[model samples]
Target chain A: MSAQPVPLVPVLAVVGIGLIGGSFAAALRRAGQVGRVLGVGRRQASLDRALALGLIDEVVDLEQAARRADLILLATPVGAMRAALEALGPHLRPEALVTDAGSTKADVAAIARAALGERLRQFLPGHPIAGSEMTGPEAAHPALYHGRKVVLTPLAETPVRARDWLTRVWEACGAHVLLMDAERHDRVLASISHLPHLLAAAYMAQVSREGDADLRLSLAGTGFRDFTRIAAGSAEVWRDIFLSNRESVLDELAAFERVLGELRKTLEDPDPRALEAFLEQAALARRLWDGRSAMT
Target chain B: MSAQPVPLVPVLAVVGIGLIGGSFAAALRRAGQVGRVLGVGRRQASLDRALALGLIDEVVDLEQAARRADLILLATPVGAMRAALEALGPHLRPEALVTDAGSTKADVAAIARAALGERLRQFLPGHPIAGSEMTGPEAAHPALYHGRKVVLTPLAETPVRARDWLTRVWEACGAHVLLMDAERHDRVLASISHLPHLLAAAYMAQVSREGDADLRLSLAGTGFRDFTRIAAGSAEVWRDIFLSNRESVLDELAAFERVLGELRKTLEDPDPRALEAFLEQAALARRLWDGRSAMT
Candidate 1:
């Protein structure tokens, strides 16, 4: 879970300096691993706020960032990765390695392959699993990634120097870093992350679409509150995740539907033992997950 | 959210003194609204724990409770209501009103009708909306019901004095008491509570059944943790709820499946706008709910 110390980078660039990117910049600054931080994004107002908050040393264009930064971290929504990578591709100085904090890996990898062309080996796909209901520059904090897992998906041909350096950077930010391939990372995340978000949003939509939505919401207890917490995630971000990780998410959804269908059939006759056994499996599994999670 | 003071009951009995029942006893004791509490349940070990935890003054049989108590709270699972009511029927003296903390109500009312006979009017069906991932007597606390909603479903034939007295007691226990009918309560709860629990359990079952479930779970973050928390609820308890409230829960499930089906089709085309719009609606509604819920 720990990584050896690495030298500070001369200049670091962050694309889409929202919670993830902004927090990364702050954490790296706190760890004294970056000499200067450059922010790049479409939103000038947000970038201004990040600059004012000292999350970044300066706000710069993508071209300037690619030319100057020793490391470039893409933290934009998954949907924007293509354009951002393409923009960063042309002006990249040699040894200017790029990494991303995207939620999914396979699509980002594919996009990087096509967009970065010969520089694809320099593009490391990663997902930093941080929890936040809020977004934007204001929500970013140094401790955002503390004790969190950061999965790095690097192609086989990527330079070990670059991979090991990024791993140390994340570890310096108080993260537990793990190496994974793009396909494996995507498959793991599709089950644990993507499908749950989809289900939560879908459930919320169903409740809100009800004739007595306000009344139903009024009667909602703590269970409803917790179950739908993830449904409040940024819509644009989730849309890109679901679309980019389409096949895996759909497969997970179908698997969930099968279980749901079985439970539905159990409810038809509603055999007491059958229902209890079905519920027991889930309850036991969920309880075990919590127990192990607490240990970790 | 505040209620006027109500005088203490001389003696009260709580059936199945787990989280809900034991917590109610503790809250009533803290409010100085109960002179003594008698616990009744099938598990002697649990009853002993309740006695040791000071959740109950003494352990007693249903007959002893029926004869000695001024009020009785049937806080057992909804499936056990009929058996409890049938047991309490013969020995119940006049004015010894009964209430419940069962999650589902319409079915409880029907069961009360059959089991309690002439004493049906004495039963005041209720549900106290409290949040907890843990259960048993050890989980009981005086503040468990503070600022929480306790919905009371009283029959028209039930005496006004009984309804008013129970409402005052719940308020004294620091709950916001709301008046509702059995059918309406069931429908509302089915939509919010029951459906969410079912979906969570189904999602958990699906994930656990996967070939690489351990790996997927190891990568689970905060979102998955929150979304699946309710799935860890007591299997026996949830089974009873799903069975007792089958019709309403099934209705809610069908409604959810309709929205889910539309989402499935949208995922098929992977249309950006449609997917974004769908997620946007859910995100907006969920955010609004949190804002209002915070105020309440």
Candidate 2:
């Protein structure tokens, strides 16, 4: 018996070939599942850089890229997704299986549905929960997606053919694929990702203002540094994320405030039992949680 | 040309041969600085393990260990420092240089001063701002102190000879030594170290308490894991630290609450400019701060 032949090579058009886009191109190219990787970006410099770096075979016009490619990947920021969808409307082939690398799914899926109509049957909004603190094509690497989880949010009208194709694309790139609804995805991410960024920034500000300014900084050691490392992310990108997920973020903030309040009471009065319980649960959860799911 | 001979090696006694103590012994052994490394602990099992692992040359009685050793390193919890000082006082040699790896400096320094009178001159209260989340003698590695900062809190009555000797010991163990006052060290660490742990514990508690607990955990990634790693530390140890540094920790907590309140407002209403500034400052601070100074 012989192994069955592989499916037809899909032509992939990657928009905004930065870290996510560039890494996807590298993974797809290495897997040999995609043919003729075409990249589309606003900056000619980045497009030239992507081509030079072998992240893509060529840079092509948006309409031409959309029409010719069998699959189109929207790898831009969530804020830019709407505009890109609008630009892609004129030439997106109805059968092309469209996907994205946006962090938030609900908004992107809505935008794709409104802009692409019947062609939206091919759309699968995705959030590949993988990345580094560093950004841009220079930071892109082939192994960046290995063992990572890629979340896909498919519409009710999405064809089984498109869903299977999208799953194959992600699996070929060495990602663990999972399905989620758009609203639930945003809510869960708000509690885990967006809220943590805000809290890191808030705590850092507190450290600068509340502590004996000179002494606090002087005494600050590794514990503080490790805790606040995430505060080192891009301001514009974080600001947009926080804004886009505002309601869920606010809900998490309020929940956190209640927890903090309880801790404050325990602190003021110094209850050993209460404090121990707080740390015990956290330790259990952290130990049991698999950190590999966050490969991006 | 004649070169001055290197200083004679000190017979170093490491009390409570756990992670910090075991690492200190191993580091000294690796650097070929100790004439003999003597291990002293309340538990016979730990002493045997430490000797077998070559963290020390011999396991000795606490009294005999203090009497024979030239350098005494009390690498135990802050809660145990006072008791250790009392036990070692009667047997400590007159010219012995004593130091500790306690997180809280003021209380330990005070306890040592009140217990040992003139013998205090031989004691150089020190805190090696270094450790990992892991524990036990087995977790100890010779490279634990490399490129880290070790803060020493020497009283005015502390002899210059003892301070200088202890500084050499830390330098031999691969640390950059710095002078700090006890009160100042407590306040500074309260903000940077203690507050962050409390905040993380609180954050984890809030997220874990949600109705859809599994959903919240499902979305947690690297940022969440890194942010909450320290929250998984020993509850007994952290509880003691927070309580010992109560005043400073309380003050820092209040400051943190104020900033968190402001951030909550920003999130609730969505102020991009204000949020941007908050993130920019945090990012700038984190990028500029030297990570080597974080060892505490």
Candidate 3:
């Protein structure tokens, strides 16, 4: 790609220099859209690794990040966002617009309101729906967000200029940015993302608990591997996500149970036609979704 | 792979020219283990496709296949197994070994017992745990079973000589062969393969029925794709599988419900630690399985 005549953002500070944060900086660097990246994190060794890995130019504290950054992105676990926002609130520059890469939006929006007070208007809650099983600076790659969806949940007081600018920046990272309200974003994520994760993990654990667990695992083929892939996601991150969006997740689980009940009825009925119809509904929809996804 | 000095089987008849049958033929051809592959199918077009794809040498009927072949493999969907066996029963040679690649073993074994009569001694109930979402001869590959698992659930009257020969044939296809009782094999498969497919299909159908389904599907990323991959399996095959092993599958579903109940309790309690602990169990078990699989 041709380098831009001028960087889009003079300085970008990334909090929690893990896969999301490090990859954001790398994507921006590849696009030649950011002049410098300042990494902030809880651990010093991780920052050093980020520097060694060329994921950052320098390491800085939250106070320095707030004072110097043209834009600041919080890529921490949602549980850590409130503290990061509180630390940044006191020193955050007037021109700086803040955003996050947290999975849950409503909780992060609430945290920003509570922590940043008046500066909360500058915060746009965003989540990049990308592979997240791998974490840390070592797992970061420039193309992590390429052709992925980045959902931005902007508040009422959020500036149009900042929203449009953030959208352009994510577009430079090869992400398609979509706008949604925080509550709706959280609910949508609970249905499509969080509930699936919980189900995979739960199924994996359940199968592992069986008396013939070893034989079952040994016999598991591609289907089991694919279905339980999300079960390998980081425990801490998922815990925070489940707890942060408990109500939505619980609601999705109930929905899943209802579907299972219907499936069980078909099985118990020994109704071959009904069973085939149920499975065919899923097969048809899955094929249609694949076709739809291929276009976009 | 190097060709065997002599063809392992002089004449091999495959009673279904779909993915499983075609792949088995292709795999044996690659290993130089079969002299001629006689294909039998209900559809002439599919049989022609199998021939054109080089998955079979020629098309033949069940009587000709039984009369002329040294070995026969019934790779048709489980629901069609009894009819196929019945067709072969009258013309079958006593020395000719018969094996099946059906997903459900207990039902197949029972069907064989009734149809094959005294010739049940020669039948081996087998399942090649390979990628199965893709069907038809075009989806078959010579290396489809490479580094995969093949489980054989032999009946009490099954001859050891035939069992040994089938094991070697599958090994030539680069699969690790394991033996289990038919009932246990069904239960193990129910827990691992069948249950995952059912859950994936059910989840995909449920998501498609949602009011915000378009939005939800648009936002779905790699996780959704992998989690629902198995829902794309042939509906008739999966329906037959679920019906054939209904009791085992229903038992697994009950087990799954118990696990989901525990998960729901933790979420409702808003117990972060308990939630984290639960997820960690699955993550740890899944990781261990991956490691074990890598080694084996």
Per-candidate chain B TM: 0.93, 0.93, 0.95
Encode model 2's per-residue lDDT on B30-102: one tens digit a residue.
8877778888888888888887888888888768877998988898887777777887888988878778889
TM-score to true structure, per model? 0.93, 0.92, 0.96
Error (Å) of candidate 2 at residue A288 is 1.2
Predicted complexes: DockQ each: 0.83, 0.66, 0.84
| lDDT for each candidate structure | 0.89, 0.82, 0.90
lDDT of 3 by residue, A2-116 (tens): 5558788789999988889999999999998999899999899999999999999999999999999989999888888888899999898898989999899989989999999
Please say which candidate is ahead in lDDT: 1 or 2.
1
Q: Which portions of model 3 miss their true places by more than 4 Å?
A: A1-6, B1-6
- Please provide TM-scores computed only on chain A for all of the candidate models, following their numbering: 0.93, 0.92, 0.96
Q: What does candidate 2's lDDT look like per residue over A134-200, in tens digits?
A: 7778888887888788899888888887888788888888988888788888988988898888888
B131-195 in candidate 3: lDDT tens per residue? 66677889889999999989998788978888999899999888889998989988998999899
Q: Is candidate 1 or candidate 2 better by DockQ?
A: 1
**Could you tell me the TM-score of candidate 1?**
0.93
How many angstroms is residue A117 displaced in model 1 relative to the true structure, after the best TM-score fit?
A: 2.1
The best candidate by TM-score is: 3
Q: For model 1, state the Cα shift of residue B101 in Å.
A: 1.1
Q: In DockQ terms, which candidate is top? A: 3
> Cα lDDT for residue B158, model 3?
79
